[model samples]
Target: MENQKLILVIGGTGAQGSSVVKALSESGRYSVRILIRDSSSIHATELAALPNVTLFQGSQDNQKDLHAAFTGVYGAYVNLNGFSIG
Candidate 1:
C-alpha cells in the first residue's frame, strides 16, 4: 500500500459499489477500504480477498463509523444502501 491512495467505499458489498471497489482495487492505482455491516458476509469476504482491498465493519448511519471510515481516506464513494439505511 506504499504510495497508494486509499479510498473509503461505503456500501462496497452492494451491486454497484462492489463493482466499483473491485475495479479500483484491480487497477493498482488505489487501495480501498470498505465500510460494511458484516465482514463475514460473502460479498464482503470476497472483496476483502482482493489485493489492496480491506474491510471495516460498521453502520453507515452511525457517526463513529463514518468518522472511522473517513479517516486516512484520500477519497470516498458513498453509495448508501436504501435497504440498510431506509
Candidate 2:
C-alpha cells in the first residue's frame, strides 16, 4: 500500500473535483480517491483511469458508503450535493 497521503475528493468526477484531482496527480505527493455515485457512470469512468486515482462509488447521504470512502484517508475535499441536504 502507498504510504503517501490520500486525498478524498467528494464530487471528484465533477468540474472542481476534476481540477483538484488533476492538480494533485501532477504534484506527485498525494494519492487521490474519488467519492462518486456509480463506478459505471461516464464521469466515474474518466476519473477511474487517472493515474494514482481510486474510486469509491457512493453518495454523501449514504453514511455507510461514505465512511468506507473516508477509510484510511488523510484528508478530504468535500462539496456536498445540494439534494443531499434536502
Candidate with best TM-score: 1
Per-residue C-alpha lDDT of model 1 across residues 1-86, encoded as one tens digit per residue: 89999999998988899999999998999999999899998999899999999999898889998898899899999887677577
> Each model's C-alpha lDDT?
0.91, 0.84
Regions more than 4 Å wrong, model 1:
none
Model 2 pairs whose backbones collide: none
Q: In candidate 2, what are the lDDT values of residues 1-86, reduced to their tens digit?
A: 27679999997877787889888887878999898777898878877787888888787889899889999999999876577558
> Where is the poorest 10-residue window by lDDT in model 1?
77-86
Question: lDDT winner among the candidates?
Answer: 1
RMSD of every prediction: 0.9, 1.8
